[model samples]
Target: MKTYQTSHIRNIVLMGSSKSGKTTLAETMLYEGKVIDRRGTVEAKTTVSDNTEVEQMYQRSIYSTPLYTEFMDHKLNFVDTPGSDDFVGGMISAFRVASTCVMLVNAQHGVEVGTEIFGRHAADYKRPMIFGVNQLDAEKANWENTIDSLRQSFGKRVALVQFPVNPGVGFDSFVDVLMMKMYKFVDENGTREEYDIPAELMDQALELQASLMEVAAESEEALMEKYFDVGELTREEMIRGLYLGFQQGILNPVFCLSAKKDIGVKRLMEFIINVAPAPSARLEVLPDESTLECNADGPTVLFVYKTALEQHLGEVSYFKVMSGKLTEGQDLVNPETGAKERISAIYAVAGKKREKVSEMMAGDIGCTVKLKTVKTNQTLCAPGVEYVLQPIVFPQAKFRTAIKAVNEKDEEKLGDALNKYSAEDPTITVQYAKELKQTILCGQGEHHINILKWHLNNVHKIDVELYAPRISYRETITKVACADYRHKKQSGGAGQFGEVHLLIEPFVEGAPQNNRFKVDGKEMVLNIKGKEEYTMDWGGKLEFYNCIVGGSIDARFMPAILKGIMEKMEEGPLTGSYARDIRVYVYDGKMHPVDSNEISFKLASRNAFKEAFRNAGPKIMEPVYSVEIMVPSDNMGDVMSDLQNRRAMIEGMSSQKGFEILKARVPLAELYKYSTTLSSLTSGRATFTMEFLEYAQVPSDVQEKLLKAYQEEEKED
Candidate 1:
């Protein structure tokens, strides 16, 4: 294969909702490009994009597959991404590397929840888009309604470059307004014939073309002036305006397609090659807020956007050449890790199929196998050049589960497998929660984690069970209290004795320490000699005050006393949960010179802090998350009612397109399996995101229940 220069390369990503015919469209595109002699169907498990075993079993895309096809003397590199929001990591990663997004809109459903979700992502990434109304040959296909929906969702940005001539089961042709030509397919294998536009469709085609030209003229001042003067745009002038508008995200030109029937596939590819921005159109962003151009003559650099563990290949690393040209057997240094690696082989990828290439120029996307330490979101540079590309930030995990191997012996294996999978998909995170004593697996939703489980059970042969993960509740005091504890142990040898008097009070941020306290109608003043403040790891602060006078207790034992207080704080008095935001004052205590060991003082302080904490207005606090849910208007009431039952506090609500945006603050404890429930309630037409907010005190009833449960757990232990 010949190396294509950066100017001859176009990078695009195929995205939309699930079952929107993305895989089939990709197959048809490959067929049209002559990369594949015949198109493969998703149902037959033979499409290049859905080659994974899990994807085949589900008949959907599970990962972003980088595919390249040589067409019109250009290398067209496109990634077919999974449409489900559960697998959104792939789409995000694709957004980072691609120049544009081919948002596939199902002709029958118009704009679905998945479409809106992914479309929002594209807007966030600032990537231009081209709409492909696919499955036009389906019995229920409605081109007019789909176009209306696009206009409603995207406004005037929906520029119609082509419209179906005959939609529905007998769909076989479309009229291209850009060329003013009719494209009629003779068969389902991209065999098409060009003809003049029929009289019946000429008026509509001319109107759409005029509208498109007007939208295009808005792209540049010069184009607008020319269009105003001539009242029309020449073919070349129109192409220039459309290219600029599309490149700047000012217009999203729509096209008609019947991917299964291979109708309009070639025409779409032609438009892409002719009008789409080349790899060099936009500069790549750097970590330091700078930019780099895709110059083949510049220093060689590569950015790995994705990594996958394939059947035979150990680990395939997919990367885009940011600058210069990458040749086989070239040595590059990972500036982040300072580790040197040799690129053994480079291949132009089309799903699972790989074709060996000697070199790939800047802006070209390809894969390389067997790197020592390179991972996704890492950059590799030539020996003398140092460059790091901006990393792709994946969304936070919303669903969590405590996973454990059924067989204890497989624990290590499970850990290794989880680590491997997490590397491949960053959205799948695993952490050992020491507070809960469970290994938690977090993902986008239940379906996301279920897919991981499927791989675990089938691929790794590790039988595991997933249970509800425990919430990390916190404990703190609400008022002031005082207690004194004495530890005395007598034995045949020297006896151990220690006494500690401590006053506990709630700690507020930026509040001054108190030196006087009234206890039992008596005022006790403390001369604080020294103070030590510590920021607790869980969430708050602990201030320890040393108010000992005349050295009643030596300074050496202060640490031990503080340690005892911390130990109690680690396991709160009411429940065995971490405590925070409390201040302790060692006002006075007695110590025997012979029995004043650290151990004795530690036990004494521990008992005293526990007793005082119980007497203090202790309260339990649960984690609250800021949640934003997007649901269709039809299901808004049901979703709202469900959230209310979970004790959610509705913050705000708004409407966008045909969906309602609901914002609420819900406790993490109440959000378990919420994604699953929302899907069930809204028939999978809703989506949501959650982020950790400030922890608030639990309700009185909830606190009582939690205290009782902890007491029972203590008894069992």
Candidate 2:
């Protein structure tokens, strides 16, 4: 390998839907660069990029694998990202680190969900994009139809940069519009060769060339004028303007290649090295609050986008150097924590292999070792720099399930395994529910958790169990009631005796953040906004200063009484549902001189809660999430109708690239299996991401059904 002074570096990430040939494409590129002796297929489980034990079994790229090749006098660092939506976090992380998105598509499938998934990301980041139609050598592959799908999915701006001379079984070469020449290759063993355009295809090639020039001319006002005046443009002018357009995201060039056969990869490599913008050429970001710009020579600031746990090898910290040169053995301040650490070692990562580099210049991607305190999304920069990149936000877990290891001994190991996995993948969060008493694992879908399980057992050698997560439903009262309780349990010589009376009502979000206690045993009405109030009697040792008129209740003993009432809330009234957000009014109560302990007051408070809950109407609250679903416009009616049946409230709808974007709020309970259902309904076209929203009351009938199910399950247990 050799280095060049006029060196060019391309930070590109290969992204697309599964089986779209992303991993195989990386394999082809490595083979083309002679990095590997033999190319590995996804079927044979020998690909370098998908080397993970789990990925090998599944035959997909489940993580981002960084691989680079020095070719065409340029160093291209390719971040091969996973195609499965389960690992979408990897895809997004790659996009944030890369300046270009090389979106791959299956020639036969055209623009499938995988292509569309990464396409949205490329558009969002405003990154330059190039489409590669892979598997062109596969039987019955149609290049033109794939281009049409791209046009339908993207727009008319999608132009052919290289045209395949022979497609499907006959695929052998491609015509480069820029060079105006044809290059041929035999995919049988992926041998490079040269070819002239077939005479019969010359006229079509000329027509495509005309379209290409027109697009290139439209890239700039001056070029447009030149083309209209002379009816033609020089090759230099076309190439220069087209490169500008692509760099500016004004044009998306479609290139052809068969990663399986490695045809057209040389041209693909050349385009990446020549067309992709250099590190300095791309934009550098700065905090909105700061005046300092991101400078390579300025104090170094690197954002750790991902971290890996390497068993006995400590940790591997992968970061994006936003500015300044970072060399091994140099110390820099952590802009986040203000702690300085000597750069231990710097290396370019490929799969699990690390290639030691003495230095990683500005805009270069690499990894370092043994950073104890750092994790994913942490900022590591010069001391006192006080700069931080925004956190890597992810969509709320749309699906959840109870996860328990098969053996009790694996319980702690399960937690440890999840912690390690979470360190690598920030999107997956595992939490223990105290009330549900289950280790709840939240993720994108069932397949998402399944992949984690695969990684856990095989990669980390830990077995785990999984089941549907328990629903966290809260119980509340509808009507207002008040009652008094007198505890007369005399197990001790002093005896346990206390009398308490209290009133309970619903609480709202705007209720005072401060908790106040008043001991005025008076009558107060429970009023829900925009609804009538139920006048109820207040009687208890507990007193609730629930936004009532002044002098309504006394202040003294109210705290103790409220504590008693709180004990009841912790236990619940009808079902032990941990009653949430309820106001308890303790008007008055008599304490036994010798027996009124906290236990007696608690018992008295419990009775009062039951009385109030019976008088006041009770309702159930379920969690809902704000969801935005992106689907093709044609599926709008079907989606809306299906959502309506699921009790989804559509906020609005909009059109995007032949797809309908639906914004709606739906209860979490109805969305557990939505991924599978949406796939079935749209035949795998609709995709959605959801975030936690406010809780809403469940309708009476639905609540009854849910309650019945819960009660039946309880009985079974």
Candidate 3:
């Protein structure tokens, strides 16, 4: 395939709720462009975008699949994204590369939850979007009702450029309200015929056409002046107004099409070329993002939306060239980490396949190879250009699950594969919990996490077992106490002798996590950040300024005592969790100047802290997460009751997308397994997301049980 410039490309992404006919719509677009002779139904899974076998079996898109078509002069590249909340990463990745998002709205369902999600994503990225109200031929599809629902659900800000002329059963095709003409189809057999507005629908069409013109006229001062002077907008004037309104987010042109029957499909294509904003007009993106205009001569740059790891072909970098042309083997530097790497190859992506290309110009969305240092959210620049293109700020992953290698033999391989996917997709986060000793994976929802495992198992040949993620609970002191330890050794030529005294006190509520350890003996010490490293919080003296006036403990031994205290804090006092916020005071202690070295004092201080914890009232604290479950309002009571059972405290909530957003603070321990439970209760329709909110004190009864359990488990070990 020959290299295409950015101006020749029309990167449109198909996004909407599950089963909203996005794949079919995309197939129709492909068929009209003559890219494919036979259009495969979603049931048959022969569609180009939904090519995965799993998608065929399930009959739904599980990931974003890029498919391209050359429509006359424009290279119409499209990505069909999954509608389910679990596969949100697919939407995020696809939206990043495309200049516009073709939101497919189900006339029957109106604005569903997933539609709201992609709409928010588009608004966040400031990407111009066009809503495609599809399936006009299906029963229960009322065009007027759908528009009302759109206004009620999405907002009245959406402007309709066309309305379905023939309702469902009488479904002939669509009427271009702005153009004041009707485009009808002869039948469902891909035959088309243009005619004057059907006599019966002309009256209603004129009213809507006028309303569209009025809305457009108000968007532009010139159009408003034209309307005032002539009392009507010229045909050219109206079209220009509509396009400009769309470019500025004022007009969300709504179009009608029945991809199943291929009716109105051709008109939609024409609109894409005519009314749809060009790559140069899709919300002028700034490389440095100071409200930039779409300029072709700006610095050559592309935002790496995603990185795909191919089993045999190796790593592929997919990006949208925002500015100047980026050719093969160019020196590209990452603005995020200041790491420089040379691009080895450039390939225009087409579905699961790719066409080798030597260069890609500005406004083009494509990929490259051998970019080890480049990553998602990183801007690739052509030196001295120094531009940080804005990256899509997506919602944080809330769903958590424990991951284990299916085959223990490939455990390390699984770890490596997960890191690659995590780096490739910013929405999915992978973390290793030291205390739980388990690798935890997080995503937008259960479906999101499941796709990761599927890819790992299928593409990487590494299977993984998934469970709930471990809650990172902590244990700290509630009261203050004092303790001391003395050690004496005379078994060898060099004997060991050391002594330590410490005051263990709880830091104020929500204290800073920093910890300080000081020396008051004859050893050197270090007070580190997370572990141990600092030698002082103050000027080095402890307790009374006169407590160690006579040098009861030599200053040389202070380092050893500090080191021991540092190790003890990381090892924890009661539950082996990291101890923070508490200050250790070595007020009075005796150390031998000659025999008491760091190791000798370390042994003494380690024991002293363990004894102090017993008296300091060290308590266990469990992590609690702020969870928001979006469910049909009908299930509000059920969700509330379920949260109550999980030891949760409700926060605040509101309604969105025919669902109620129920907010609650629940212990992470109980929520770790909520993914499977919530799915079963909501029949896989309800979605709940959670983030690590804060850690709180475990009730005495619960704390006692955990303490006993820990002791028993330790005994077994």
How well does model 3 score by local distance difference test?
A: 0.74
Report clash pairs, candidate 1.
none
TM-score of predicted structure 1: 0.98
Q: How many steric overlaps are in each model, in order? A: 0, 24, 20
By TM-score, the candidates rank as 1, 2, 3
> Per-residue CA lDDT of candidate 2, range 361-380, in tens?
66777889877677677777
lDDT score, candidate 1, position 455: 92
Give lDDT tens digits, candidate 1, residues 526-555.
999999999999989999999999887899
Those runs of model 2 whose alpha carbons end farther than 4 Å from true positions after fitting are 1-7, 186-200, 287-295, 459-463, 489-492, 509-543, 546-556, 593-599, 633-645, 705-717
RMSD of 2: 5.1
Best by TM-score: 1
Please list the C-alpha lDDT of all candidates, in the order they appear: 0.92, 0.74, 0.74
